[model samples]
Target: MFKIISALTLFISVSVHAQTPDSLLKPSPIKTLTTQQYNALIKGEDQYGMGLVAELNGLPSPDRALKYKKELDLSPTQVATFTKLAVELKRKKIEMGNFIVTNETKLETMFRTKKLNESDLIFYTNRYGLYQGELRNAILQASLKTWQLLSPQQVNKLLTFKKS
Candidate 1:
């Protein structure tokens, strides 16, 4: 009876941990923000989307920075660099957001005109493609910069922490 109880408890513990958002294989922040807040932020501009794009591309958040600063054994010097990197990323995000707004006006013009047909639809879709491509490239740049800022050993530690 003791053996059976212990085995079951171990299995349950492992299962619960596996389901956690910080699981090693998951690269994204799993925290959920309320839909109302998300909608409010995204309504006027695509800057919010740019931020998400950066995150999806592995640009670490401030929260992630705090987690890694301790885990990676970063010095004061590195922390300062990381803060600068984050600021650069924010600027890139804003640029992408502005690009989206510029494209949006063109898209809206096509949308409002009765001239919209198959070709117009194709053109409209292309605008979104361009915006997404630009956004993704900006994110990639930030991710690469962040990677350069950290040592391999620190990255390995991050992986281990995620697994734990």
Candidate 2:
């Protein structure tokens, strides 16, 4: 009886002290982003789902327009134009994203070192807004180009595709 009680006590204590394996712990999505993901965002990977703006304007992005080129009966010229626009837009987004990321790092360091002033803060924050606006504008411009390229019938067909 004594030995059984001791074994039971040891088992209970061991179980209580057991550690959960690290593999069993779930990572937080917001906090556990990998470096590649951070780099992609800094390099303008559209982390904020900004492509939705094109859809809101009743047009597809250059990439999307290209994707549905067959269904839209796009001419070879239209295809060439969209390809150029997509490349240009990608470059613009990266440029703006690089500016914004550099500014953000500077602002963060300044704040950490207690070098921030009201005007400086406003300037930095406004710059962020401008960078975002420019990114959004580039996306919209591509959408506008796609809209111009497609006919009304093609637009209707694209809309139907969007629905399904």
In candidate 1, the residue pairs with backbone N, CA or C atoms under 3 Å apart (3 or more residues apart, or in different chains) clash, namely none
Measured by lDDT, the strongest candidate is 2
Off by over 4 Å in 1: 1-63, 115-127
* All candidates: TM-score: 0.52, 0.73
CA RMSD (A), model 2: 7.5
Q: TM-score of model 2 relative to the true fold?
A: 0.73
TM-score for candidate 1, please give it.
0.52
RMSD of 1: 11.7
Worst 10 residues of 2 by lDDT: 22-31
Distance from true location, Cα of 112 in model 2, Å:
1.2
Best by TM-score: 2
